[model samples]
Target: MSHEYYRRGKNWFTAIGLLFCVMGGIVLIQQLLIWGIDFVEDFLFNAEFTNEKVSVAMLCFGIFMIALGFRKHEEKR
Candidate 1:
């Protein structure tokens, strides 16, 4: 019984982490693209804007992943 419990716990961790990684990959890709576009547009025309928007957005997304991980971890606990 204890072994089964431990196995399930490990599985939960793996699943949650993988979920973040997969979603994070997609989000990170978009964030990178936004930076690339923003940079090109700004450089070509001398446009100034909030440069931190992309970073902040990425942080928020990371927070979401952490929150989701916590949720799954709590479910097991």
Candidate 2:
């Protein structure tokens, strides 16, 4: 029962992470198309957090969550 609950939790994490990744990717792509290469340069170097930066952060966080969800648990000796 506990294992099943853990599995369900992991599933939720993966699902949410996937959603975040998709949304972030879409927004990032849209920004790229609308703003051009200069935007990319700004995203790389600028200190201020912009919408594009938020999208990139979302993308990174989503990937991290996904990885965490899929990580294997070690058996206690």
| 68 Cα displacement, candidate 2 (Å) | 1.3
lDDT of each: 0.52, 0.81
How would you encode candidate 2's per-residue C-alpha lDDT over 1-77 as one tens digit per residue? 56434433437677888999999999988888988878776875788777888888899989998997788765565
lDDT of 1 at 20: 53
> For residue 43, what is the lDDT in candidate 2?
79
Determine which window of 10 residues in candidate 2 has minimal summed lDDT: 1-10
lDDT of prediction 1: 0.52
Q: Ten residues in a row with the worst lDDT in model 1?
A: 3-12
